[model samples]
Target chain A: MTASKPISLKDEGLEQKKRSTPMGDALRQFRRNKMAVVAFFIITFFIFMAVTASLWSNISFLDAPKGFKARHTINPAGLDRVDPYAEPGHCARDGLDQGKAWCALLTEEQRARFPNSCRVEIPDPNQRQWCYILGSDGGGKDWMTQTVYGAQVSLAVAFVGSSVSLLLGLVYGMVSGFYGGRIDNVMMRFVDFLYGIPGLVIIIIMQVYFREISSKYEDSSGIVGFIVEINKDLGGLFFLFIALGLLSWIGTARLARGQVLSYREKEFVEAARAVGARDRRIIFVHLLPNIIGPLLVAETLAIPGYIFAEAFLSYIGLGVQPGTPSWGEMISRAGQEGGFYSNRHMIYVPSAALVMLTLAFNFFGDGLRDALDPRLRGR
Target chain B: MTNVAKSEKVMTAPAKKKDYGDPIVSVRGLKKHFPIKSGLIFQRETAAVKAVDGLDFDIFRGETLGLVGESGCGKSTTGRTILQLHRATSGTVNFEGTELTTLKGNSLREMRRKMQIIFQDPYASLNPRMSISRIISEPLVVHGIGSERDRQKRVEELLERVGLNPFFANRYPHEFSGGQRQRIGVARALALEPSFIVCDEPISALDVSIQAQVVNLLQDLQRDMGLTYLFIAHDLSMVRHICDRVAVMYLGKIVEMAESEELYTNPLHPYTQALLSAVPVPDPDVEENRQRIILKGDLPSPANPPVGCNFNTRCPVAIDVCFDWDPELIEVLPGHWVACHRVT
Candidate 1:
């Protein structure tokens, strides 16, 4: 160090590529994990299926439009959608043979209600594939289409609910932990109390109250009215979102506070203070990046939980509008309509979708938690 | 808030160099005691750790004042207290004309820019989340010293001056070696062009070879910039090599202070005698035959230091008077000072 060394960067013989950042390091590690990679693809495939559900839905015999312009947009009322009440193996979802087999188990009145077993088979193979692809629920809704639409609902619940949790929890916990003393004591006690309450029960109570309020004010004109309108359009999903989101932030706050407690005493934080940086700078700059890794992995892993919570609420008949086609709604209505008596495929289709999604989220999240730190990745 | 902005502008402007040899930082009976609080909710102080019991020293402008002591002897605490990193418990630390203890808010931070510290453990000192360039220019950014382009240019200059390649600025702290990371810490400290720096055992964490390189770097930096330093360390040989004047401390009090050569050849206090003797001499004959003065007993707890003179519990030549009265630092020679009743 007595004399300045004259070696240039190019002469050092290191790689000329862009330097790896923490995110980049985490990404490099994520790509190396086989389960995570597979889970990532599967999740994206679910998203693609959800986003393009209305396409390729129409069968040939229904006289569905064949033009590109007709198929590009959503077919809400066209032959693209099956008779949601059509029996599982009837012309609603499966071929003539399965339809006859399923029709044998139904009473005469039930047989008359879903007329799919009485119709002739359509000769088009592509159209036929759309029928038996996942069969249908008690509503005669195509199971594959319902599964795709359920993905959309799950994604909505996950993102909106998690955002609420992350925003509220990060700020609450950071403030509580950073200014820890009486304030931390008082605030953390409140969070602990919130944790003790059954989150599902509280959300159910909230959902019941929300339903009454939204229906009573459905005709008014204001923010509440506006929300009621969205609720009607989304088929009661809006209330479920609010109920689930309001209760999910407690765990995130606890995790964030714990992380902040551990990081507040690190030397880098003291070094930042030594540089004359203000408290806000210390919290956001020096402190946040170090703690955000685990928090992110937790949030990702918790998405499946949010999805399941919404599913549970819907299953108990306290979530969504009657015909919303959410997976839980499908399962609940199938059982009520007695599609499970002999035609068991009604329950099997939606259950398989639910299990696959939660498993995918868990595998991806587990891999992410391990790979978030750059040092850990290197080792 | 505006005051901070104004101070930032003033600090970044051209620095006016000052003459050396006059006292730059004057400490008078400075003390720091950390409270040990009990209870979870309504906390109470049970005891206090007297890290720096009563310190009095003068750091001359552009000179390195070596502070040597055994582990847990408050050498690091003294440096931190002087920098206002840990507020002093009592007395005064007057930097130039301003009394440091009374400073608050923007003024305190403004005063902080005039002084900086190079911390030990290069691995822990730097922020791993930031790039090298961001770490170096953090003080500049905090003070709002320059435009982004200007800060980048200044960072590059500082890197080169600290003997690191400027192009490595984009890399993170984890990519660098311990020695290079120490150099980066130096660059960060030098970013503000502070008049005084507390080098808090900057070389203790490095290898023996790396320690020499870093010490030489610090010396070169001080010479070129005319910076004053309070170099705190336990390495007696290294302290002797780099310090113009040396102060030996025991149990949070200076036992002897004098020119490095004088303290080495003509030590007055028994504590200083034991410390210097512990440093291995280079010559084989001298190393084998040199008289060794090994003191007894472990260091007394800072929470409850022994009454009267702190060294009485371990001093080899203890007298009855030594247990009842604490000695004060007083000049016995032209420039040499000793804090022992035996010294004439």
Candidate 2:
């Protein structure tokens, strides 16, 4: 029976020859979770959209220069091009020009009120001349282009903000937890002080302060001027990254500090110390890797919070400067002068994107939590 | 063949006489007090936990010295302090004719290469994220000992030496059982070819069947390498099997010290006798009829140990002087030491 079992097991073992590493196991676990996989794909799609946003927006009909005539058949007058809010599928009315009888259902007064609304003329021969796929916003800009471009800003903020926080938090927490004495006490208390302050308030103050500094040196030609130039190119989003990163690190720092506190006592760290590993090596090589599982999960979950915070700040006019395309800024525009009722797509488009992004991050983060959990490894 | 014979002769002879010419490491009045603090904003030191208080011992060349005590008796702290893993609050650790406690920076790190420690928990001792090869090679990498290829070859050789399959080098610690992980740990400790190692309860966390295998491996390694060990454990039987001499601790102080055979056969200190009495004999008749000395009351907190002697609060043979004056560790017999006034 044992001989027969060995023969069967050998065949099975050959099929399972791929060695299972910690990372491989985690990836396998992540693949098994259906929702997390879907969320991961969604996030990947958004990332793709964010990276290629300029390409998408450049060709968009809604991305036409201000006052540029469409010169299309939809209306020789190009009335739709000048309108602040064009309804989606408005081009369906142009089919009336093909002599569709449905146009006759329109009341005589309605026909008089919108004489050229349903007219069809030859579109511009130039391929570049196109219309909004999701319709135009209150500013006569393509909603599709704005959305794609807006995604770039939000995603960048989340990625850069979270990375900055992770770096700061990892260093701060490692130093605090590893040194562990009066230095740890002082450092943690400082983190506690940071925790007490409202993140948005600090961000607003920093944004306003940096904005003044940037403007003051805008024209001066020196290192400060060079910084101003870079700041201008990034717009006020640079300040947003700084503010979010600086304030957001407290949570990650606390989590990292707690992890380090426990990990510093682990025998591996002692073993490392016993082997004459320097403090830097002990913290980075031995301690950090052990604590990384939880740190990664914490970082993943924190990214969505940064995205939401960016959107919230932008909505209140403290985020990206005016004229830069942002989801929150678009939502703010949508709420103005009853644009919400008239052009609901403008509001709904960015809102849905924001909601989906945050939800995707949350689901993906949850999957990562399960995948990276040490207790589940080797199974 | 002559070298092998000479080493064989060295191994059979009593470890105390042949290889114990001079102490490799000497610790004098070692103290490690951790401050307990209170108050949030303006913290105040409320009290100090004397984890290790006024310990003195010497580890000779190529001899295994057992440190036996119950949990929280500061045996682990003593081992760690001797290695300079934890800085002593006061006193000196003299290793290889240099005062280790006084050494700093590169000097201390240099000294560390000569000493190593095997941890109590094998699961926690090996980095879970690292492959066995990486864990074994980390010390070499830190010390800049060899080229990458050389390190890899050494790692493979070490894995084989520790009785693990050389192919297992690529596997993570989680894939191994407790015993295998411990072997990896031993390989790591041996990587630098250290003269001394603190086996901090190395086999306590292993299965009974695997415990003997690990101990035998250590013994074999010590024989091959001429390694000295401070074997810290609470398992008296296992300690007796491996250690040449043993030091018994209570609270934060050593209560007794002697040759393993003498200490077990004729324990003089009240605490040592009580501890030895608790070790169950294997024979059915002896196990059933052994006179167990159950010490009354729990171990007093090290933060507020009894003023006279740490063991006074729980000493079964306590006297008035035992409560008022601490007894020093004195040589009661040649090659035997005890720390109780009542013994005299």
Task: Go through the candidates in order and give each one's C-alpha lDDT.
Answer: 0.79, 0.80
Span of ten consecutive residues with least summed lDDT in model 1 chain A? A63-72
TM-score of candidate 2 versus the correct structure, residues matched by position: 0.86
lDDT of 2 by residue, A1-379 (tens): 1111112323334335567688898999999889999999999999998777767865655332211111122232344344557665433222323322333566777656556544435363233245567777765567777787788888989899889988899888988888888889899999988889987788889888887888798899998888767766775677788788878888888888899999888899889888888888987788888787898898999888899888888888878877777888878878883556777888888899999999999999999998999787546
- Candidate 2, position B266, lDDT: 89
Candidate 2: stretches off by over 4 Å: A1-17, A64-84, A92-131, A205-232, A337-340, B1-20, B38-46
Worst 10 residues of 2 chain B by lDDT: B3-12
Instruction: Give the clashing residue pairs of candidate 2, or none.
Output: A72-A123, A73-A121, A73-A122, A73-A123
Q: Give the TM-score of each candidate.
A: 0.83, 0.86
In Å, residue B83's CA in model 2 sits off its true spot by 1.1
lDDT (Cα, tens digit) per residue for candidate 1, span B118-207: 988899888888999999999999998999999999999999998888888898887778988999998999898899999999999999
* Candidate closest to the true structure, highest DockQ: 1
Per-residue lDDT of A237 in model 1: 75
Model number with the top lDDT: 2
Name every residue pair that clashes in candidate 1.
Answer: A84-A139, A84-A140, A84-A141, A85-A139, A85-A140, A86-A140, A93-A131
How many clashing pairs in candidate 2?
4
